[model samples]
Target: MASPTQDGVLEALRPIVDPDFGKSIVDLGFVKNLEIDGGRVRFDIELTTPACPVKEEFQRAARDRVSALPGVDEVQVTMTAQTRGRETPQGGEDLLPGVRNVIAVASGKGGVGKSTVAVNLALALRGTGATVGLMDADVYGPSLPLLTGVSGRPETRDKRILPHEGLGLKLMSMGFFLTDDSPVIWRGPMVHGLVRQFMSDVDWGELDYLIVDLPPGTGDAALTLTQQAPLSGAVIVTTANDLSLIDARKGLAMFEKVSVPVLGIVENMSYFVPPDLPDRKYYIFGQGGGARVAAEIGVDFLGEIPIDPRVVEGGDRGRPITLHAPDSPPAAALREIAGAVARKLVVLAERTPAIADANISWVTN
Candidate 1:
């Protein structure tokens, strides 16, 4: 039997292409640290995001391809990721210099569980071993401190405000600055200043993702964030109802107007699954409104998060469902949504010539 040469191995894996990139893994230079000894083969397949949904498929394909080699007796395919970032025009001087992607989680209006979705989404991303930060951009109603159980004024180091750490995530929120009864009665300029301070004056060091929970609506705070923040993408959270979907469309329009890509729409509380009846679904807020709106607007329908009581309880206690009850249906749905968001960002990054050039490692023929 002949030994499998490096060129032969590359050829074997060339047929396995990334669905998002529409190119061969070998051509994209995803196969790394390849080593061959006798009949055994070993290599790592590095992806753009740790939360890639197709990682398992890639791993299976690579293992099967390499194991089929004539001289290969064993195959070791390690899946890894180095999160890619959108290219900032300012480069290293950008406010979020260490943060790769800034994702805004917004809603059409309040009372749609947007903050809950944001908290759990950040937690889900962090669960995937990605360094994540959560910024409650809702100046009027900051929820990060309450949702993550992180409170008190954040300490300042030198000239930068240190983001409070909780639930394995770096967090910043106006909630930390106010007492429980304090109301933010600031004007538009003050709101803008606070949002800018959160971006530039905070020390959010080296994060794969920074999930910004934008205040519900297309008002001053939301508009300010969309304009000022170097947002990679936005996810609009809405309930599966007509009124909520209406606001979702407005929120979607806001991001579009700012030239920020809307990654997709996440339907929170899409259905109610009673604890007693685990197998049954109750469509308390009508049905399929989220999907219909996404289709009408030409955006992706990320997924639906079923209404779980634990979702509220977890947030109230500063323990998001994705963290405390990770195996529950709602938690699973949030994880799926997070993965979809990560994949969408990758697609968007690939579409941008500057970001694509900076992130992709192309193999020469």
Candidate 2:
């Protein structure tokens, strides 16, 4: 029997295409470190993100295809990721030079659990072995310190603020500097300066993902973030109800006006599954509002998160459900949403051209 040459192995895997990029894995340069000895075949399939939803499918397909070769007896497929990012030029005034992707988690209005969703999503992304950072960009109502149980003023050295570390994530928030009852009565310019400082003056280090929990509503803080932050994409968090959906549309329009891609809409509190009735889903906020809005607005419907009391309890205690109760239904849904967000960012990075300055142009309304 003839040995399987590198050319033959590459040909065998050419049929497996990346669903997002519409190109074969071989053609996309995902296959790496190929080594063949006797009947043992070993290679690594490097994906764009650690949180890729289809990585297992790629692994299975690669093993099956290579094992079918004439001289292949054992196939070892190692899955890896380099976490693709937008082509932001390094140095020269790039704010987040070391951060690859900056994701804004926003909502149309308050009371939609946007902070909860952002906390869990950041935890979920970090769970996948990606270096993640969570920035509470809600200058008026910074909740990350409460949600992640991280407090105390961030230390500064050489004029750069070092982000606080907690729950395996680099954390930054205005709440850390304020007392529980303190109010942020800053003007629009102050909010803008604080948001810009969070990006440029914070030492976030090298992170694969930086999840910014933007202030709810398309107001000054949101506008400033959309204009200054080199955001790769934005995720709109909304409840499955008319009121929330209305604000969700306004939020979507805000991102669109600034030329930022809306990764998708995540419907939080879509339904409630009672502990007694594990199988029954009570659609308390009406049915399919999120999907309806996504379809109506022509964006991806990421997924729905069920209303679980534990999610709130955990957040209140600085333990997001995604980190503490990962096997729970709500946690699973949040992780799925995180995966979708990661995948959508990869798609945008692949389709969009690299810009010299990552900061988007401000559109006057």
**Best model per lDDT:** 2
What is the per-residue lDDT of model 1 for residues 110-138, given as tens digits with 9 covering 90 to 100? Answer: 88888998888898999888999999988
Model 1 CA deviation exceeding 4 Å by range: 90-93, 242-246, 355-365
Worst 10 residues of 1 by lDDT: 356-365
The residue-level lDDT of candidate 2 at 38 comes to 83
TM-score of each: 0.93, 0.94
Best by the TM-score measure: 2
- For model 2, residues 40-93, the per-residue Cα lDDT tens digits are 899999999999888889999999999999988999999999998877664535
lDDT of each: 0.85, 0.87
